[model samples]
Target: MTPRAKTPRNSGQRGGHVLRRMRASTVYLLLSIGALVSIAPYLMTLNAAFKPQSTLLSTQAWTPAVPATWSNFTALWSQYDMSGFIVHTAVVAGTITLGQLVFTTFAAYAFARLDFPGREPLFWGFIAMMMVPQIVTLIPLFLIMSHLNLIDTYRALILPYVFGTPYGIFLVRQYFQTIPADLEAAARIDGAGTWTILRRIMIPLSKPILATLATITFVNTWNSLLWPLMATSSERDEVVTVGIAALQGQFASELHILLPAAAVALLPLVAIFLLFQRHIVRSIALTGLK
Candidate 1:
């Protein structure tokens, strides 16, 4: 009988490494499939953007042979006044994002670090607000807007965020809690006041969360429709979402005008998301929250 060759002891370790790598590869494959599935609709819209009106309204699904049409974009710009819509959207979204960040940051810092009477209760109250359906406050918010004569203005679009969002404060505060007290203590020993520590130390260190919040706020404002529609009855204050909806409603059957307008409305949020995705991941990792 031929002597069997002995397997080396290290062969077991090598086999274990191979098994681990196979598991990792399987995990990556699953994640890739999920990502592609999530992105499919957006990809379809992108393809639709370049296709002609005839192709867009067709019952068929995605088609690679569809020749690109620059006219769809031109029609989008001229028919819908997309540039104006983009500007309006940008103004409202940018203001809300900046305002929310400033107010929420300060509030979050206070909740996380400062001790005072009623602080815990107030924070809990804010958390409770997050549970309440937003629709419950819509009528009240609208009444306030009407009384303030902020109707048909960016002010109406922006006012809600200035008061601060409960979720925003919660996110920042959670992240702030993870930061060691020693950092703030060091700032205090160096003659930094509350505002100074917040501005110089906390804010800089919280860039990841801040960037994430701004991205979310920007997307929310940019895509907002009902509030913009209710607040601004005219195109003068119409953001992209409202503008796109109005264009589709008016055009009805005109894919040439409607589809491209929809595409235009989508591009800004996508661009911003891409730019800040790293910060978004870091924020989620650091905060352990969405």
Candidate 2:
């Protein structure tokens, strides 16, 4: 059979497809370039982490660490007491994450499910707190901590954060609101209380969002510098971010040591993201839909 004639309409359709493909290719090319630009520093840091101070200082920034040594990692672990910093960071980040998850779960459940006087107004007011920059509350928080004589204490780090955050509440609440009311109704028919319904139904169903909130809280708490710096006076109580800064000061000229220390500080966050990335993406999509 003869092939169909190349009609003007078919030609136009083919041309439109070509144009669309070209636009997509251009978009992808730009995105790839942007990704490489963003990742270049981290690549440099990874390379620098393994080199000796002499080599790093002598070589260009982009050069890979030839004959890579574990010395930087060793020094960071031992001389810098990175273990202590890691432990402190873990404690603070873990506690804050747990607290935010628990408290925010309940708060979100309440706002989404329970009937209360002025609930909408209260929730809106709480969300309004998100609009206020955290720096605005720094002075008041410092004064309160000072009044309680909690400065330089773990209480100072953990206590202030454990109550829950506005963003966490909002994210979880949005997810919770998406949950079917029928589930709660069925649970109630089975004599389930608010806490039980939350635990067995809402929390379980909202895993993706909770994971997202937990990951965010953990990363933020772990990377926290300004607050931890002000709250804790001594090196013993400082988190990894502050510890890394102090480590830089001690090894001011040592790129090898500083980069490795920064890399070490980054490991937990990297691991957390790799582990929960699916949930994080799902949560974002879910939140957007809601």
Candidate 3:
């Protein structure tokens, strides 16, 4: 038999595979570097959180919390009102999330599905306000809260956020619009009222977006600092972030304690993001599909 010849196609395929692998490797290398850079501060915070106060000054910056102890965390809970602050923050965040879910969903549904007068204009107005900095309205919010005698109260923390955000309305509205109108029209053909259609058809299909909204709202509210710091004075009203800030003066020399308290405030948001990150991305993808 004549010697078999290797075709150009085989070599081209091999070369393409090689090039693809090289590109993938380069992309992975860059991503790995970026991940490390992003996580470095968090790793350092954990190091300091577990390091003994005496060793913190002596140890190098990159030193691990060798023989790591839970004393800092224990002391944080025992010495400070951390537990109460966490519970209070959770309550505030939960209330705000629930409120946003209700109000934002309703508003989004109306804008998306209804034919009310001024609907488009109102929605565009909401979109326009999103460009305005939160700081610009902070004073007005504070005055409203003060006038309502809500300062230093849970109402102050919850009220400002409970009405839903512009971003939330926009996100949910976009997602709502993506839902097929056929399903809604079919429901109406069966004599379903708007409320029935929204309740049964719309909400059930909206779990992903709602979950995304809830995660974002809860994490943002949990990490909220400036407003809480400004609005709340009493330890009873203060959230963990504010409490952690107050520790700066008291635990200035105690790196372990201060960092651990900070870690407590920081880690919840990090964990929430890590857990619900996929939902967030999925929601965005779905919203942008239309």
Candidate 4:
């Protein structure tokens, strides 16, 4: 029996498949290169963090930290009161994150679920705040804090931001709008109050977006430098960013110490990202879908 002849159609389809595969490979290659480019600085910083001051100047920037020393970390912890700065940063970041979650959830819920006169106008007006840069409000915030005699206190750090940010409110509100009204109606039919429905139904269902918002708030607050620097003068109230900047001043010529201090400041954010990465991705997808 004669074998079947290859047709032009079959050959054309095979060529199309090869072209698609080539395109995909090119895309992947470009993406991988971009990822490496983005991460190169972090890699260099990590290498520098463990190198000695002498080695840092002599070795290439990309060189791995061989025979890594612990002295940089030791000096940071022992001499610089790194523990106190870490604790203060943690306290401020944790408080801001918690406050944003609670306040933003409630505000978003009200905007998303409830009907009132001028509600849309009010929400849009509030969200317009997002268009305003923090620098615009910086001087006023400082003056207010100073007038209230809260400068250098945790209150100065936490109180101003605890009321919920415009971005947080907008994000949660968008997520809340995606939920079906039937859920709330069913809860109401069962005599569940607004607070009960929000606590039991909305909050649980919106955990992914909430986690994303919390992680964002935590990282932003932890890395905050300008506000903390302006508000607090003493070491006792300073956060990790301020502490790291101070390390730069004290060890002006020591890249090894400065890099380690910066790396240490980054650890908590890295841990948080690793823990909540899935939720963050989900939240991003949800936002895009909405």
In every candidate, how many clashes are there?
0, 0, 0, 0
lDDT of 3 by residue, 164-277 (tens): 999999989989989999999999999999999999999999988998999989988987888998899999888888888888888887777788887888777888888888
lDDT of 3 at 137: 83
Write down the RMSD of candidate 2 (Cα, Å): 2.8
Query: How much lDDT does candidate 3 score?
Result: 0.88
Model 4 agreement with the true structure over 72-168: per-residue lDDT tens digits: 7886677678889999999999999999999999999999999999999999999899999988988999999999999999999999898899999
**Candidate 2 or 1, higher TM-score:** 1
What lDDT score belongs to each candidate, Candidate 1 first? 0.86, 0.89, 0.88, 0.90
TM-score of each: 0.94, 0.91, 0.92, 0.94
Candidate 4 stretches with Cα past 4 Å from truth are 1-5, 8-10
In candidate 1, stretches whose alpha carbon ends up further than 4 angstroms from where it belongs are 1-5
Residue 144 lDDT in model 3?
93
| Model 2 whole-model lDDT (C-alpha atoms) | 0.89
1 against 3, candidate with superior lDDT: 3
**TM-score of candidate 1 on Cα atoms, chains taken together:** 0.94
- Predict model 4's lDDT versus the native: 0.90
Model 1, C-alpha of 60: deviation from truth (Å): 3.6
